[model samples]
Structures are given as structure tokens and as C-alpha cells.
Target chain A: MKNNLIKMAIFIKTERRVFFALVFLFLVFLINQGLYTKNKITSQDCMDGKCSALVPEKPQLSRENSFYYIDDLFKNRPSGYYRLTFQEKSNETEKIILKLNTYSEKESFVGELTVNPSGNFQNQEIFFFLPEGFDSLLFAKENSDSDGNIFIKEAGISKLNIESEKELVLLKKTVIGDTKTDLIRESQLSADYIYPWLKESKTILGQIFRSSDEYISAVSFNIDINKNLNPGSRQYVLSLRKVKYDRENASFDGQIIADLAFSAASIEKYRQNDGTFLFPIYGMLEKNAHYLLSLDNSKVSVDKQNYLEFKGSKNNDSYGGGSAIIKKEKNIYIIDGDLYFKIYGAEFHQENGVKILNGAKIEDSGKGMGKYSYAAKGKFIDLLDLEISSPGMGFSEDSKVITAEANDSASFNYTVNTIYPIGKMNFSATQLKAGWKKVSVKYSFNQENWFDMPFSEGIESRIDSIDNMDNSENSDNDSSVDNATDISAETTAQEMIQVFDFDIIPTMKEIKTVYFKITYNPNDESKAHSFALKNLQITADLKMK
Target chain B: MLKKILEILIFAITLAMGFYFQWEIANFVFFILFIFLILHPIPSRFAAGSAIIFLLATAFLTVFKQNDLAETVAIWAYYLMIFTAMLSFGELRKEEEKDII
Candidate 1:
């Protein structure tokens, strides 16, 4: 009985010792956990500075008589033609034959061009050419109701020098219809520098001008600037007269207005050190104009400053239907609306800036999460403002980014490294609390959190290659289970391959926005967030002796 | 005789509880202690004879059945009896040496 008592005593002693040691170990663990919790810091606990961000400006379009280009190779412009008659007075024949050269042998004749009895001529082609030194060859008919001019040269004439030793002046003249007299009268400045029959035959006001450098030159309705005006500041009132077609009752189905008022709002300027400037002003004008008004000339000239031009084939009385749009493979564009929101701007920024940017707006659209809550180091980020503030409790580490996992009711925060200013920020979590349910991001600046949208981050791609099985037949009955698995598979492999054809699938549809909390690291100046030190200002003036 | 029986009873109870608790190592230890106490009450020669039987049984059961409840109990009994027999053999050896001297 005594030994039994002794044994029981020893057992109790050992048990008590073990229990105390376990309790001590547990207490030590708890103490360490408490210390860590106390030291935890959050975004709000850190200092504050400017919450700086860059909001992209919305893209716009404009149009003018400016040069826009598709590639570096193609050059385009618009030109117009007026009455140009060739003549030579014949002394013997008593009759004159009028002749003009068609420049191209393989002429794609647009339409029938003719000089009417009224002497009003029409040229369908906007572009025309002449051989060298054909200047001063255009002349007006001398007699009314008479073909008084004869051709010194035939049509399709080769290069000819018609230069005179005495300077010859080309005069710009206007022809008017005289309905009362039922006869068209022609007048010109005679060799004596005066109109001989001005009092006898009513003379239209005419002006003589020097010929330009190019004999084959284009004459179109253009703004005649007395003084050069800055492209952006220049504005004009343009009025287009209704077109009169020669073919009566014919379909005047084209809708191209000859004149347009324009301003350069998006000119990309490049300033040289010497103060000279070169930029793609025409491309800017065309893009912005067509984007806004849908009337950019399909053909645009991208050469020379202050010499921008646009040309388009008339269709539906406008530039449309099979018109080539400015296609850029990839470029960046600034996007902004009434309110500058990060996700809002990013949603509209596209890989190819020329293509349209389309995405859903979570704000006011009622399509996305309306609210979010986050807690990091006892600090919370306000969902509406996305600003962080301390909860007056635990602390967070400096220079670390607080990753917030937001749900309908609860949000958890984890700290991560800083992300780039322009790229994506991705976050993931595997372990979760009970009744965790599903988690979707309210904002993820990075593509790591993909949103499934067809038009935004999706493209149509066809399957290029596929795996197939041969139809040739062979079988082995004496085989193990693993070998039979391969053998029987061969029996149906050909049919399976034929059935399982490849189809295109969307890889990622949409990207979520990632919100980052700034970290304040005291040890590193460069690595620290800009707002790590909230400036305290005190201004005063004093005089010292 | 009553004391001896009581001693055996207490040892058996200890072994039973220990095995129930899955305390296999503790049971063997207590079984050896019980053997030492039992040999103190028996004639030295008889104790030696019983020790061989106890050791054989213990080796057989513990090695074969391992942690089986029934077999574990058998091992406990075998160890306890073998420990008592070894104590008795020590005394016998002492007696023989004394006689030879």
C-alpha cells in the first residue's frame, strides 16, 4: 500500500510538470503574436502627400484642306478644272477646228466632257496633266456664235515648247449668261492694255495674273489667306453651292461638299532647336474631323507645312461606304470624360488607338460592384474615394502596398510589393474563411484579374493547326490493360479526331482595376511612397536685428 | 498467503488499466516491479522454476500479437513473472556461492 502511494505520487508529479511546461510554451506563443499585432501598420497610419495620377484625355477628330496620310508611300490631293480652250487663226481654210490633248493614252474616262454653246466647259476628273511648257496656251473664243479657232497641233500632242520671248500674262476670266440677248459675247484686254469694246459690248471684270511654277497645276476651291493665320486659331465660314449636273434628270447621287470650315485642335507639333516646326497636322485634322463629323477625305496629302489637302471619291454625297480608315496596329491614346476616373479612362484606352474603345462603366451603369471595404493593419480604404485611413489601432509596414480583397460585406487586406505606374497589378488568394463564397475584384489595375468581355479584351482568332489520328487499321488482342487502353483507342481515334475539330475561343475578356495603398518606408528615401511625409505648414513674418 | 494474493490482485489491476490506456511500455515496467515484490514472499527455489515459464510466455505473446489487447495483457503477465523469477535466481546463486565457500 505504501509503494502504491509512492507510485501514484510520482505519476502526479510528472503530469503536473508536463502541464506547466505546455502552459508556458502556449503563453510564449501568445505573447509573440500579440507583439506582432501591435506592430502592424496600415496605409492610413503613414504620412500623406499628393495622391498624384495621370488622367488620359479623350480622343477627338477634325478635317480641313490639309495633308493626311495612310502610309509613307501614298500621296493624295484634290484638284479642279475650269474652261481651257486651244486655238489658232487660219488664213486660208476660212474655218477653225478646236483641239485639246488627252494626257493619258489609257484614260479611264469618268464621263463625257464637253464645251457647251454657252462656252461653259466641264471636266469630270479632279486631276489632269499637261506636257512640259504648255503654259499660256489656254485662250477664249474670239467670235460669238462661231467656232473661229483652229488647232495648230492635234489631240494627244507630245511635249511642245510654247514659251514666248516676251513675258506672256495669263488672265483669269469669268463668263456670264445673257438670257435677254440670246447671245454670248466674249471680251479680253487687247494688246494695247485696254478693253477696245468695253462701251460697245458689256465687259465682265477680269484680272491678269502671272503663271505659277508648274504648268500642269491644280485649281480647287481653297481659302485665300491674305495673311497666314495660325492653324489652330484660323476659322472660316464655308458655304457650298448646290451642284448643277449637265445630265438633266440624271442621278446626282454623290454628296461631297466642296467647302468646309475647320480648326486644328489635335496637331502633333515637333519644334526644332532653330524654332522651325514640323508635325503631322493633316493626319491630326483628318482623324479628329472624321471621328467627330464622319467626313474626312479618304485621300489626304501629308507633305509640307500649311499645305494639307484631302481627296475622296464622291459617294452618297459624302465620304463613306468602303472608305479606308486610318488603321494603326498599336498606339497609346489619352482618354478622359467629364470626370477623371482611373478605371473609367483605362476602359476606353485601346491597344490600337484608331480602333474604337468600348467597355462597360461600373459607375452609374449599375453593372459592377457598388461598394467595397478593406482592412490592412487596422486601416481601411474608403471605396468611393479609394483613400486610406488608420482605424486608430494596429500599424502597417512602410513602403508596402496593401492589397484589398473586397466582397459584398467583408474585405481582407494583404501587403505586397509596389507595382509600376502604368502596368497591371494582380492579386490572388487560395485559403479563405468559412462561408467565404465567391470573390470578385472591384478594381484591379492589372490584367491578372481578367474580366470576361468580348469586344474589350477579346479578338477573333482561327485555329491554325490541329492534331489528328490516322485511319489506317491495326489491332493486337494479346495485350495488358495499359496496352489495350492504347490499342482500343486506335480503333476510335480517327473518328474522335474528326469530331474534335478546333474552334476559336476568347482568352481573356476584360481586365479589372487594381487599387494600391502607398507604403511609407523610413529607411529608404527612393523606395518610399511620395506621400510618406504629410507637410505641415506655418507661415509668419518677423524682423531680426 | 492473503498478502500474496492481494499483491497479485493489485498488480493485475494496474496492468489492466495500463493496457486499457494504451500504455504498453508503462505496463511492462510495473509488471517487473510486481515481480520483485512477489519473489520476496516465495521460496527461492520455487520462484526460479516459475520464472522460466513466465519469461517464455512473455516472449511468445508480446513478439507475436504486439499491441493486441489480449496479447498485451499476456505480455504484461509474462514480464512480471519473469522479473520475479530472475530475482529468485539471484538469491539462489548467492545461496550456492555461500554454500561453496
Candidate 2:
């Protein structure tokens, strides 16, 4: 009995020891797993500094007209000043650096500097130093000029440090520039000159499509000088005097459109049609005091043949001058000069009751007047040059119709080389004439054997709608089929349909070309069935590749 | 005594295998060890020594090589083992005192 008790005691002791050893191993495994999990969590959180980094919220600025700001400086404007005030926090730093970021068309400006504290140590303002010339060149131009526009996205102070006796203390507070009131404003003006004689003006008493008015004429003149004139001796004055007719109703009108003036000169000599006394002027001189020499219209002889005369002389000349008789001849102005100038002129005319300048080479080519039509067509009109093809009849370019005559059935095929993966086919058909029509597209990988192209859900829905419309139209006039003449009138409306969401071609692998086919057969043997199919387009998912 | 030694040997082998093949077996062995320590009466000094050895081995393995799922299991098992060791030691001391009385 004592031996049995000893054996049981030994067994119990061994079991306890085994349990302790196993527990020890378990504890070790658990500790290792815990450490691994902790590391994993830490690593995941470190991505993009999303969980670890602290980002400050930027202040919002109120914008005017979705563009201008109330207190903001105009971008690239001269003297563009912005003051950034820093609110004193618990962790006061001795030196704070303010960073500026600007984006402009010509150049991008990025600047940073250590800020100087204001009078009040608690509140600090940093002024952005912008030069006058820089602002004028950058901000003083139109948006279309392609220069000098700056957009400030964000600005903030970083690396803020305080110097202590022993060490440098880094502040955790982030200083963000107050964008609400920090902006510049700029104002500018632009001007252009437009001549009244060149522009066409509409008249009330004119036909909408055609006008009975004839083309009118106007005259212009130019002078080519042979001798180079000194800067101080090149001044001249040009005058155009009209004949004194009824004064209220004059047949011819004359005006000096443009005069290339000289600086300061006296006329050396005067002759008639000699062309040897004029001098070539190089550059434009500063516009000094000049005179316009006028001739007395009442003293001059006036007649129907004698219309107007152009005269040019030195500004200081009292009597003799260069003269040219102005005459209009078939879209041209012939200037017959009595001295050294002869000008091939431009003509102005009246077309369709509106005055138009024809021969003058105007710099600005304005928009043309739209053609006026008495009868207007449909707004959605598409002109397509399509090549219609069939099996036995071959192909014809610019064909408008694919027809089946009498009791015959016909199919027209159009081959399109699709470099992209086409998902749907769309087309419009006109004058279907109560006929059975089937439209299908087949794709080829090797250009030898063709398989039907698949369609998407959108195309399937469009096809269903087209089928429904045909059924509804057929049911409305069941007796129209017996009368073949009525079929043409009934099917005059064009039908547009998109074929989609088909499982015909499972995979479009290297699909080089697709043939779109339209087959038609009329129910009646007496009637001819014809339909014009146009504007065939295929949509593709280019992103799939 | 041989059975107890064989049991411990098998446990050590399974724990090593768990690190390579399947770690679930090691976890199962740990549960059995915890149950035995809870139910059986042992000396407090012995249990304390075993706990210390287990903690040192766990630390070494964890620092050297470990996986995600096993690490998670190890962490929970660590806390459970610590609690069971403390409870078993306390029970052992009580039993020792009763035996002395």
C-alpha cells in the first residue's frame, strides 16, 4: 500500500512539472505574437503620414464675383502688399520664418524670410516686398496676353525655433498666413479705333434675300518719295477739297483718310507729273505742331466731270503745291498727280443695300455676313459622303440609297476599319417604306472570316425602341400595305437607332475591321422598297485596352 | 516521472514545429498547461521558476522571429499565462501552509 502511494505521488509531481513547462512555452509564443502585431499596426499607420503627421486647417477668404477678393492684393500688381499677423500662442518662439508661394504665367515666385516682431510683441506682421516694375509687367496686362497673373494657393511658417541659454526650442504651433485679407486689386483699360466708312450698315428698305442697289465707289491715294529727307526738313500737309455743287446733295464725297506726316521741312521745288522731287522718309517723328492748308471751295470751278482734287505741300508753303485729280473707275481709285505723286487707290462700294469697302487692305478681317435664305431647312442636317456597297453590284461612292426593286431583296455593306474596341453602332434610316429591314455589324480579326459584333445595354434599348415604333406604326394603318402609294408617305419619318448589349462576339481580339450591313425586303411584290441610311457611327471604350 | 518527462518533451517538440508548420498546436499545448497548473497543487517556488523561464523564452522568440497571426495569439496567451501562474502560485502557497499546519 505504501509503494502504491509513492508511485501515485511521483506521477502527480511529474504531471505538475510538465504543465509548468508547457505554460512557459505558451507564454513565450504569446509575447512574440503581441510584439509582431504592435509592429504591424505601427507600420500601417505610418503611410502618407496620415495617422502620424499633424496638418493645420487653412483660413478661408471671401471671394467677390468668383474672382476678386475684398481685401486681397491683385496678383503681380505693383506695390502688391500682404500683411500676415501671427497670434501669440503659449509656446512663444523667438524667430519665425514666413513662407510665400505664388503661381504666375510668366514665372512662379517662392520666397521665405525670418519675420520681425511688430511693436506689440504678441502680434507680428510680415510685409511681402513686391517691386513696382514687376507688378506693372505681370498684372497690368489682359488675360489673353499670356503673362503676369499670380495665384496664391497657400502660405505657412515652418521651422519655428526659440533660442535659449542652453538649447534651441522647437515650437509645435504652425503659423498659417491669413489669406482672408491678404490680396491685391488692379484696374486697367483698353482701346480700339474703328472707321465708320469701312463698316456695313443695314437699311430698312431692302429685300430679305436680294437687294436692287448697285455698287458705289470711293477713292484713296498714296505717294512714294525718291529722296531721303532730313529729320527736321520732312513735314508735309495733305488736303482733299470737294466741289461746291448743291451743297446739300453732292454726287461725290472726298476725305483725307490717312496722312503720313513729315517732321519739319519746306518744299524745295514744285512740278506737274515729274515724280523726281519727293524724298523717302525712314522713321516716324514725334508729332509736333502742324497745319492743314485749306483751299476755298467757292473760288474753285465746279462741274459734274470735275469732282475732287488732292493736294500735298510743305506745312509752311504759301502757294505752289503737288496736286492729284481723284477719279473712280471699276473698284479702283486712279490718282492723276500734276507733280511727283501718283497713287493706285482702293475703292468702296454698296452691296445688297449695305456699304462695303472692297479694295482697301484692312488689317482686321471682320466676320462675314451670314447668307439670307427665304426657306429654312431642318437645324440638324448632316452631310456625309458615303460609299454604298453590295455583293454582286460592287460599290458606288456618294450613293444616297440602298433599294430592293419589285419582289427583290437587297443588302448593303459598309466596311469600317476600327482601331478601337467598338461597343455600340448607331445609324439613322429614312423612307423605310413598310419593309422588313435587319441591321447588323460583323467584325473580322483576320479580314477573312467575320463574326457579328456585340452590343451594349444602351444600344439594345435603342433597338427595342425602334422595333416598338415600327410595330405601332404598322398597327395604326393596316390597310396602307394594300395601297403601295401610301407606304412612301407613311414611312417618310427618319428613324435613329443604336444597337447594344449583344453577346454575338465574346472577345474582340485584334479586331481590324467591321462591316455594317442593312438588308431590306418589301412585303408586296408590286411596291419598290428603298431606305436612305446615314450618319453611321460606332462608340468604343478606349479605356479597355 | 518518465511519463511527465515524455509529456514535456512532446510539448517542446510540438512548440518548435508550430513555429514552422502550424502554430495552433503550440497554442493548444499552452491551454493544456494552463489547465494543469490551475487544477494541480504544486510548490510556489517551482511555479514561479517555470513562469520566469517561460517569460524569457517568449521574449527571445518574439524578438528574433514571429508572424502576425501567431503574434496575436501569443499576446493573449501571455496575459493568460501570467494570470494562471500567479493564481497557481497563490494556491500552491496555501496548500504548503495547510500541509505545514
Candidate 3:
């Protein structure tokens, strides 16, 4: 019995030691886990700061209108008598006068008309004035400022006389400076433009399928011109001159009616020859000063390069510049120069801002390659032949990238590579702990041809280092001392810097060439704008290897 | 005592292998853990630890690369939890012998 008791005692002692060891191990494991979780949170913070989209809200009252008027006289007025034959006896001679004024002018004007419905819908008359003489047109064109004014090309006009009134009408009004006419036309022209495909269409059960064709029934224009002008010392005037139609044709296969017109064409060109509608326009410009003009749905052709684009409605009250989208295509083209204008012309200067320039507010395009498809803005001249190039204040280079820094302890673990064109990029430095941190990006056209492309400015780097400067005994004393030392040091050291290695080489392609986007964030808040380009490059030599 | 230590070392090697090759043993570990939790009168925390190790191993494999084995192991683990819940409900009315089994 004594021997058995001794053995049991020995066993119990050993078990106690093992249990204590296990508990110690458990505590250590828990500490490690807690540390890991904290580090994970820090890493998430870094990711959020770098790539998350935090776009600023648009201003409440942005200068939204692009229409500027300087020339007092009309360039092209409607001369020929317009005869309209309506199904009902509708006869009326409407004398419509185009007025001009800046937003600051504070005066409004209107035109009067009489409607008389007569014989058939075929012979109806809607007579108006226009700039008719080519010399007068050129002189008038030379007279106005060259800001953001788009001259309407003859191809943008379409007029249709429908035999049936049951045809549905679709209205689309793009910003005056927008140049995506083909996309709009494609979306508007196809029979599927308004209706879904038969396979994709859902039946209401009561409605039956029919083989009847649909066409445009009526066309109208809603033109709004707003300009801020000063009278005496500053010649502030606003004028809306009628534009002329270049061609009129009908379609047999029901493809679409294609019509083109000059910038001087009546507001009626806002409608298609097929009687489709484009309406509710907003035009604005400053009086006696340089202004930009934007043509709606202008057409331009890119030399086989895809570019970033914006497509959305402009708010009536403010100008947040609509949302932007990127489009890729082999050939880039604009519908016309309808949205192109400049404020340098004689009419724009001497006319005292009388002629209300057509279109919307235009962005300044600095010295850059301007193609029909892509538009660049800045203080320099546009290298590409754009309809309008307005020179304005240039933006800072650092303004291109968004950046942020987090205060206190932080860690970064998972490093995600923003996928870009040449190849996939990986970060060697994935984990960043406390203390001042640094990162650099290398850019290249080919995966093997990496070049050091450094960040010029606006990149913030920070480190959460231990602050042992506070020598205090009390808890409050310690907190205050450390807070003052650390916060002050952080504020002083908060400088954003970005640097990359690069001797960027452009690649040439044999067959199909494309510009590839490597990596990006859809919603990054640090950026002042909506988008950011880490290391973007464009060249004809860029091709798929 | 020396022989017992050697045997334990060998057992540890098997555990490591089971953890590394989670696809093969993940379902088994999940099943054993369920049995130990719901059916066994005594709660075996050791069994829970083993199951967690197996789960971590599987997660590590899937997180690194795309693999069918890791996907299969994860799916099995989810189904096992559901099955265990159902079996515990059925055990409520079972005879003592059936419950013990």
C-alpha cells in the first residue's frame, strides 16, 4: 500500500506540472492571436487609405452652363419659308426671337407666336431667322470668343415626318460639351434602343406581339442660356442665332434618318429628322471674359486608342461635372464639332457678349494631344484638333493621386497588387509595423523593362513609433505628456511622398493593340476626385507582346 | 518511460500529418469532434483543438492557392455541423443505450 501511494503521488505531481505548462502555452497562444488581430486591423487601415474611394461630394452651386455670348449680330438667319402640312388644320406664324444675356444680367425675354391648324400635316410652315451668308457666317464666327463653344456639324441633323402618331418618342439631352454622338446614336437608333430584345422582353400577358413598325412622331427644342455679364465697362451680351441644316434624307430599311447641320442651324437640330427629341438644355457663360463652350454629342475619331470618358446628366442647379466612365475601342471618333467652341474670335470679343454661344461650359484643354475621342483639360494649348480648347488654371501634378495617413499604432499585412497593363506587380514589402514607413512603385511597359517611376508629390508616409519622451508618474500626466509629444511630432512629419523607378518604354503591336489597366480601387476616399492612375502611360508603341 | 516518450513522438508526427493534409482528415476530424461534443457524455476539449487545427490547415491551403481539395474540405466541415445538430435533436428521445452509442 505504501508503494502504491508513492506511485500515485508521483503521477499526480507530474500531471500538475503538465497542466501548468499547458495553461502557460494557452496564454502565450492567446497573446500571439491578439497581436495578430491588431496587426490585421492596421493592415486593413493601410489598404483603406491607399485604394479605397472617398470622392468628395460635388459643390452645391457649380457653374453648370457652357453657353457664352459675345457677338451682338446673328451669323446665319433662316431665309427660306418653311411649309408644314399637318393632319389637322394647324396654321400659325410664330416670330421667335433669340435673346442673349449673362446670368448676372438679371433680365429675361420671350418670343410670341400664333398657331393656325389647317389642311394636312404634310404642308406646315415654321419660319425663323438664321445666319445665311457664308461670309457673314465666317465674320460672325470670327467675331465671337473661342471658349467652350461647339459648332454643329451637318451630320448631327435628322428630320423625320411620321405617317402615324402612335410611334413612341425617345428624348436624350447630353451635356453640351459631350462628344459621344455615335454611342448615343447607336443607343438611340437601333429598334432596340427603347424596347428590349424579344428574348429579353417580359410580356404583360394582356399585350400581344405585333409586326408594326415604330417611328418618331414629333420633335421640339428646350434651350436655356445663362450668362453673367457686366454692361458698361464690360461688353456683356447674349444672343441665340438660328442654325442651318446641311442635308435631309429618309430611310427605307428603317435603319435611321441621318442629317447634318452647321453650328448656325436652328435649335431645331436638337431634334432628329425622324422627329425624335432632345431637350431641356442649360447654357451659361461669363460676360466680356474668356469662357469655354461645350457641344452636346459632338463626334471625334481616336486613332485606335481607348480613353476615359464621362456619361451622365448634368444637374440643373449645379455643376459637379457628371460621372466619368472609361471606354476602349480601336477607332475613336466624335459625331461632330457641335460641342466645340473658342472665345478668341472677333465676334466673341467685339460683340460685347451678345451672341449666345451654342453648347455648355467647356473645360480647359492644356497642351496635350487632342484626338476626336479623348479630351484633355489644362492651361496649355491642345495638340489635338479639338473643336474648342479653353486655357484655364492648370492642376498640380500631385492632384492626380489621392493619399491619406493613419494615426497611432498600425500594421499592414496583405499587400494587394493593383493590376496594371505590362504585367502583374507584387510588393516585396507586405507587412509594415510601427515607426515611419516607406513604399516605392516601379513602372514599365514590358514586365522585363521595369523603370523607376518615382511619385512626385502628394504621397504621405508615416510610422507609429514609441514615444518615451514623457517622463511622468501620474496617469493623467503621462497621457497628456505623451499626447502632446506624439501629436505634435506627427503633425510636423505628415508629408506624403511617392517614388517609383521607370524608364518607361512603349510597346508596338502587330495585330490588335490595347491599353491595359493593371489595378485600381472603385471607391477610394483619399482622392479629391473620383479616379486615380498609379502609373499610367500611353503610346502608339504600346502593343500586346 | 523512454519507450512511452518515443511512442508519443510518433503519435505527434501523425497529428502533424493529419493537420497538413486536411483534405483527407478534415471531414474525419469534424465528425469526431461532433461525436465528442454531442454524443460523448464527457466534453473533450482536446478533440475541439484537433478540429480547429484541421480547420486552420484547410484555411491556409485555400488562402494560398486555388485547390479543389481545400474547397471540398471546407464544404464537408459546413455540412458536418448541420448533421451534428440534427443528430443531437434526435438523441433527445433515444434510449440510453442509443444515446450512448
User: Candidate 2 at residue A117, lDDT?
Assistant: 29
Poorest stretch of ten by lDDT in candidate 2 chain A: A203-212
> For model 2, how does the per-residue alpha-carbon lDDT over A1-545 read when each residue is reduced to its tens digit?
99999987786665665555556656656654443222111212333443332344232211211121222233434343333333432111122223232333233232332322232223333334443433211111112222222222322111111223122112111122111111111101110111111111110000000111111011122122212222122123232222222212212234321222222122222211222122211111112211111211221112211112222322211212222222222221212222212221112233333322111010100111111101101111111111232212211111222222222334444443333333333322332222323333454445477665443211223333344233211122111111122233234234323333332232655442345454432433423333333233332222112
What TM-score does model 2 achieve against the real structure?
0.18
- TM-score of the second chain in each model? 0.36, 0.40, 0.35
lDDT of 3: 0.24
Model 3: residues >4 Å from true position, as ranges? A1-453, A456-545, B1-54, B67-69, B95-101
Give the clash count for each candidate.
35, 23, 143
**Top lDDT: which candidate number?**
2
Residue runs of model 1 more than 4 Å from their true location after superposition? A1-545, B1-33, B36-101
Q: Give the winner by lDDT: 1 or 3.
A: 3
Per-model TM values vs. the true structure: 0.13, 0.18, 0.20
Each candidate's interface RMSD: 30.1, 36.6, 21.2
What's model 1's lDDT at A309?
22
Lowest lDDT 10-mer window, candidate 1 chain A? A337-346
Candidate 2, position A385, lDDT:
11
Runs of candidate 2 exceeding 4 Å displacement: A1-411, A420-487, A491-508, A522-526, A543-545, B1-101
